[model samples]
Target: MILSYTNIAIKLALGLISLIIVINITGKGNLAPSSAIDAVQNYVLGGIIGGVIYNNNISILQYLVILMIWICLVLSMRWLKTNSSFFKVAIDGKPVVLISRGKLDTEACRTAGLTAHEVMFKLRSNGIYSIKTVKQAVLEQNGQLIIVKAGEENPRFPLITDGTIQLQALDSIDKTEEWLMEKLKEQDVENISDVFLAEYENGNLNLVKY
Candidate 1:
């Protein structure tokens, strides 16, 4: 009986060490969920707890098997997040337009599963007393609402990014290679090769050095 107990203890220790490493790799982000899928992950984490606590009955092999399954599920979700926009929406719900053109869309609110009280709370938190001040309100997939006031600064487009001169991007913005070279020269940058990243924002090319 003593021998059996010692073996069980060893298994429990090993299981704990393995679990700690797994949790670390999976990340603390899983702990604070922003979506329904995150809620499901928290629930599924119970299996790890169960396996570790019931080490006498659950073998090390069984623990590994379950953990592998969990890892695969997480990786698959990440893959879907990158590959399919539809799947991304299914796991992390699509953003809903709460207010558009100074008009509140009650249907969008209902679809986002947010109560009127919650919407008001979010707005007030953003220091918006009246909905009229909001030109656009978006309920982001992460359960955060973004409010854009009328006459807000125009969103800037990025061009010539990531150390590579983006000819297409330059063409899209109606800029030529000579213009880019001139901008680079003004920044005291001799060549594009020196730039780790370059982007045109607000009609200016911002360059990052290597």
Candidate 2:
């Protein structure tokens, strides 16, 4: 029993050390994810450690060897990405244009398996209050949207938030409650309670509901 505990403790210590070393080399990609590849690489590296750490048959030296191999493979892939364009493009796909020239590209949306509502939601989350403000929106390889708003566009933040009204936001945008209700009616939403979020920009009302 004591031998088993000692073996496990050693494994844990070695595993943690190996994990820290690998993560240090992997850089911010494994720490704070900016893309799907980063997240996947982080998991795959962790999965390697998980699979190897507790195996009784594998000696600590063997474990180190296995982990080092993985690190080398990851570094080789990184090197290829830097050295070869084809490898880079094949591994990381090019960005797709979802919206262009202030108009929704319905075909691109369909190709990306994204709904109009989702695109607008992402846009709104990025502080875009109206579709007209967007000159081009690119769907990044990591599934994030990169929106290029029209030049020197006005800022319009949320006025109605989750069934509650923000009177200050309304006044700043020069809109009235009656106008908001009319906009809601135009969208077939009956009451303010039905509205999840709403913003007005460039003579257009951007609304989202539960």
Candidate 3:
């Protein structure tokens, strides 16, 4: 009985240490996951550790091997998400535009799996009582609602993220691809893919290049 208890204690310590190491290696985002993948990884890691901690059949060596394999899989996925835009979108979907030009987009609401009441609730939580007062609203991948009120100092949504143009953002701002390309040219940016992030506010295109 004492030996069994000792083994459990050892397993608990190892599990805690493994979790901390993985979080540090991955990023603090795992602590408060902002994307579906991050949330899933956290849940799965917890489940794995919890499921194995009490099992006498699974030796410490086997447990460590399982953890190592899981860590490698997570790291590979993160690497792919970083290097490939398609994978990033596939893993963490792009933001959905819920409101544009002071109008509600029911289709977007449906796409986001949010009902009218839920949208209103979120807006109300943000101190927005009237939908008409909103100039633009986007539902982030993390389920947070980002609002740009009417007559505010420009909108806050990004024109480009991870080298891809956001068409919804452009539509919200009443801009076009041609206009964006022209602005990029004005800023001496020869290629769209060179930009890591681009935002338009107060009549200026701010760029972060890779």
Candidate 4:
């Protein structure tokens, strides 16, 4: 009985150390997950530890091997997501425009799987009472609503994120790729890929460079 208890204690300590190592390697996203993949990783890690900790049939070496395999899989997925835009979108969906120019887009709401009542609730939580008062309402990938009130001079959204042009943002602002390129040229920026983030507000362009 004493030997069994000692084994359990050792496993508990090793499990905690493994968790710390994973978190350090993966970054803070595992601590406060913002995407579906991050959340799933957390749940799966918890299950692995929880299920194996109390199982006497599993040796410490076996448990460590399982953790190492899981970590490798997670790292590979993260690498793919970083290098491939298609995989990024597939794993973490892009934001949806739920309201544009004071009009509710039912199709967008449907795509986001949000009902009218839910939309209203989100708006009300953001202190917006009427849909007409919203210049734009963006449903972010993290399931948060970004509200832009009518007549606000602030940029509704980023024209570029992570050095990629956001065509949807251009469309929302009634602009085009050609217009963006010209504007960037005017500001002595020749490469769109050099920009990390670009925002347009009140007929002015703001850029954050890589």
Candidate 5:
């Protein structure tokens, strides 16, 4: 009985140590979820950490090896995201405009798989009493709701991201590619592929190049 208790204690300590190392490698950002990927990672890490502790068949050595492999994968993904915007969008997803021009965009809400009430709860949590008072509310990939309060600065939405045109964004604002091309021409950026990110804010177009 004493030997069994000692073994369990040893396993517990091993699990705790492995978890700490894994968390350090993954960084606290995984816990604070700045993207949908991070939020999913948090769930995955939670299950792995708990499983390592409770699963009797999982040896301490085996658990540590598994965690190390997972850490490598997460780190690799982060590195790739920094270098490739297309990969970033594929993994994290682009932020959706949930509320546009002081109106709830039900289509965007459906795309985000969140209800209007849920968005309202998030808004109220941010000290917003009424959704009507918002000019825009974007559902960030990290699950954050970015609000443009009424009478505040004009809401900015992505026009182009990672050299890809956001036709939906342009359609929502009643603009066309010809108009976008004209604006880009003014900026001396004649090609769409030259832009890394473009946002329409305050009735003006701001673009960044790769």
Candidate 6:
């Protein structure tokens, strides 16, 4: 009972601290998070938070020591990111180009740990539909694919359907609500609420009726 109570207290303290940190952070797109450094910072924060939770039989001094060490590591990395672009790249990694100049780089695909079918699927989801239409496809470090078309006009892409928001598809097409509502109305969807879902892309709107 004593141990359990102690555990609860430690967890409460850690949770409060971690929540404050997370609340202060800005939201970001999956590929490009608001702060580039947040990726590495989270891991260390997790460890410190974890140390507080596992307070079983460990002295408060020991926990403090570990927390201090983690803080040092985080500070060191932040210091390095300021002075060394090489270190920053090594930590965060660079975007891997899967397609370049209308050609698929098979070697880059392999190195990026993506199968040909997966690459094709990502491209298709992005509205490219054909590899020939893609000028460049970059696999960002955050595991999101970024595609750039060769043409001046960005082709309309479908991003929602069946009452479910397709996040991957939306990110690929950079879609918005205004565009979605217009597409829905174009398909004679008089009420957005009446429709179960709406999908748009390639100059078309696909809707699911309630």
**lDDT against the true structure, each candidate:** 0.69, 0.71, 0.86, 0.84, 0.76, 0.63
- Tens-place lDDT digits, model 6, residues 1-210: 256776657665755554454444322223234345665566556766665665666665666566667556755765675456577667667668787657889999888889989998888887778778876677877777878686623433235533444443444455676776677677776665566655554656667787
Candidate number with the higher lDDT (2 or 6): 2
Per-candidate TM vs. native?
0.62, 0.61, 0.90, 0.87, 0.62, 0.58
lDDT of 3: 0.86
C-alpha RMSD by candidate, in order:
7.7, 15.8, 2.0, 2.4, 4.7, 12.3
Check candidate 3 and list the clashing pairs: none
Tens-digit per-residue lDDT, 1-210, candidate 3: 224877788888887887788789877634678798889988988888889878888899898888888889888888889899988889888888898878999998998999999999999999999899998899999999999888776657788888889887787677899999999999899888999999888888999999
Assess the local accuracy of residue 200 in candidate 2 as a C-alpha lDDT between 0 and 100: 71
Stretches of model 2 off by over 4 angstroms after superposition: 1-3, 23-30, 152-210
Clash totals for all models, in order?
0, 0, 0, 0, 0, 1
As for candidate 5, its clashing pairs are none
lDDT of 5 by residue, 64-140 (tens): 77777777777788777867877887887887888766788888898899987898899999899887897677787
Q: After superposition, which runs of candidate 3 have C-alpha atoms over 4 Å from their true positions?
A: 1-3
In candidate 6, stretches whose alpha carbon ends up further than 4 angstroms from where it belongs are 18-54, 153-210
Error of 6 at 159 (Å): 28
Best by lDDT: 3
Q: Flag clash pairs in model 4.
A: none
What TM value does model 1 have? 0.62
Query: Model 4: residues >4 Å from true position, as ranges?
Result: 1-3, 201-204
Show pairs that collide, candidate 1. none
Q: Which model scores highest in TM-score?
A: 3
